[model samples]
Target: MAYRKVHQIIQSHSSADGDGVRIQRVHGFDNPHFSPFLMIDELKSVSPDDYVGGFPPHPHRGIETLTYMLSGHFQHKDHMGNVGELRDGGAQWMSAGNGVIHSEMPMMTDGQLHGFQIWINLPAVKKKDPAQYHDFQTEVIAEKTLPDHSLVRVIAGDLTIKGDTVTGPLQQTGVPLTVADWRTQGAANISACLNPEYQTMVYVYKGTITIGGKHIEQGQLALLSEGEGLAMAASDAAGVLLLSGTPINEPVVHYGPFVMNSMDEINQAIEDYQNGTLV
Candidate 1:
């Protein structure tokens, strides 16, 4: 086992959406080959005015999307006749197996809207499965508090804290990928010894962190490689999300929002979407 340091750091900023949404792409744009994990985007809004209208209905395919809300509320509707609302600390995991049209809008309320959307690529075989949705309220998520009061929420995968497996919305996948949201305070440090066989990355939401003596601030993304574990310490209170997964070694044929193994597959997806066969 080897200890690997953060390989890259990039800051996020607001785009042209006129909304207060800032995106920090941890691994998608730079390293396209990081399989199982396609994209990571952090959205932060101070008030409803900043993100009221929300993202309109859109289509997705060949991916599983995880939406974790830290604060505020969101209502979602999909073409599958599914509708749900999530408050603070809630999450939604949707598998856009074949295709799905959905939209997420912030409820008209008082405070802010903050959350993260992580895109995980599907294996070649599972890409054509029927679309599905899973929603988990904050209370339903498994949480573990460390001796120092650091809290961790297991979103996907097995997490053992102090010799006990913390339970949450667990998704069992043969491909080997996991995501956890961690919040800590004081001079606390939380470390995880990840399997070197998998690739890992971390995105900071608030506060600052020191990894391998390098400091990463809010809105920054860190990509790690060739490591057994990650040693991270917070200078002040902080929140971060850690994602790890095994790489899919197959050829990735990606076009726009659809990902497949071959050009013909991409064409088929397009034709299906156009022919109303994919919903």
Candidate 2:
């Protein structure tokens, strides 16, 4: 019956990346508090100018990028000879182990592009593994509808609610984590059991929601205290992302798009990228 409490609330800030694409970013910035999770970004815009530029080809190493789209479409092409499409209600996972060069571009000219991109840290053991990429369609993701008309989409982990358990499709996500999109159509409360050892947090992207009686507004990331479960309440329609994962206790040295265990490794990554062996 123990519920988690809000430990801290960090507001997302506007940051431009990928050829002038404006995005709201929840930065981790080598902070130990956000261990295993490096960053979370929300790209929500109806204007073509806001997102049309898209993400150009870039190299990443020692990390994984998990992208979920609520609307619009994204075409992904990578140097690994992989091409994928992320449509509305779909998701993609790309593990830049060793290294990989890729780009994500919008397929529409005028429409809503609402989505999230989360960066996860790869442990030292898996940091040098071969690169992997997978695209999940709308139907592959597990979804649950509550009696109160609330909807839940499991993106990367297991979700337990009222004795019902739903496991997501990404079983080998390089780490243990839980990510879900919770949309409440009306005033309702959703509480679910979670692993006490996992560091749990929630990101509110639409309307407002309360975690353990503390109000979390839009674009806010609420870090939660260690507990057996999470209790969140919303007054009306709201959209939130539930994130929980096991902490990776290791040195996180980040340099641009590359993350490593030490500065020397970071330098090596840079050298490799410059030498055109990044892929």
Candidate 3:
């Protein structure tokens, strides 16, 4: 019956990556205590110049990237001959297990571009496996509207809003991870639950939400302590992302887009790329 408390609030900072795409980023790569979840980037822009450059072909290994588009369009192509179109509310999951080279280009659309791309660390055992990719439309991701007018979308795990529960489509994604988008249409209270051992974080991107009697505003991410209960109340319309995952608790040595358990592995990845054998 214990409610989790916000241990610390990390403010997202402005950063540019992938061919000059502007973003608000929150990273925890240096701290393994936030294992499994390496980084979260909010790709939002009104000017085409902000996101038009897009992500060019790049190599990655020993990690996973999940790109979820809230309101934008992106075309993805990989060395494996995989082609995908990431549309509004759609998502694409890529695992650079052994290695993979991919490019993501923006497709001009009618409105402002906005989305989130999350980087997850792969465990040592799964690092050597074959690369994998999956691109899905928005309808495939479980979406529900609560009686309170709050919206919920389950992307990677079971979620319960109010009293309704829904399971996500991605079941066995190597790492134990949970990701959901929750939003309130107006003044309302929200409640949810998750495993006590899992590390959890909530990022507010719209309006303001109150947790543990503390107000969290846009561009702020709150790290929570061990507990199963999540409670939030918003006086107005608000939107937030919920992320939870079991800690990997392993040594993490990351280099650029490659993440490994040791520096030797990182060096090998660089060598592989230099030799054009990364893919």
- Among the numbered candidates, top lDDT falls to 2
Question: How should the candidates be ordered by lDDT, best one leading?
Answer: 2, 3, 1
Estimate the TM-score of every prediction: 0.89, 0.98, 0.97
Error of 1 at 256 (Å): 3.5
| Candidate 1 TM-score to native | 0.89
Residue-pair clashes per prediction, in order, are: 0, 0, 0
Clash pairs of candidate 1? Answer: none
Scored by CA lDDT, what does every candidate get? Answer: 0.77, 0.90, 0.87
CA RMSD of all predictions: 2.5, 1.1, 1.2
Off by over 4 Å in 1: 16-33, 108-110
Superposed model 2: Cα runs more than 4 Å off: none
Candidate numbers, best TM-score first, in rank order: 2, 3, 1
Task: For candidate 2, write residues 1-279 as lDDT tens digits.
Answer: 788999999999999889888899997856777877899989989788988789999999999999999998989999889999999999999999999999999755246889989999999999999999999998999999988889999988898999999888887887899999999987978889998888888899998999877999999999889889888899999999998999999998888899999999999999999999776
Model 2, residue pairs in steric clash: none
How far residue 68's Cα lies from its native spot in candidate 3, in Å, is 0.9
Q: Whose TM-score is greatest here?
A: 2
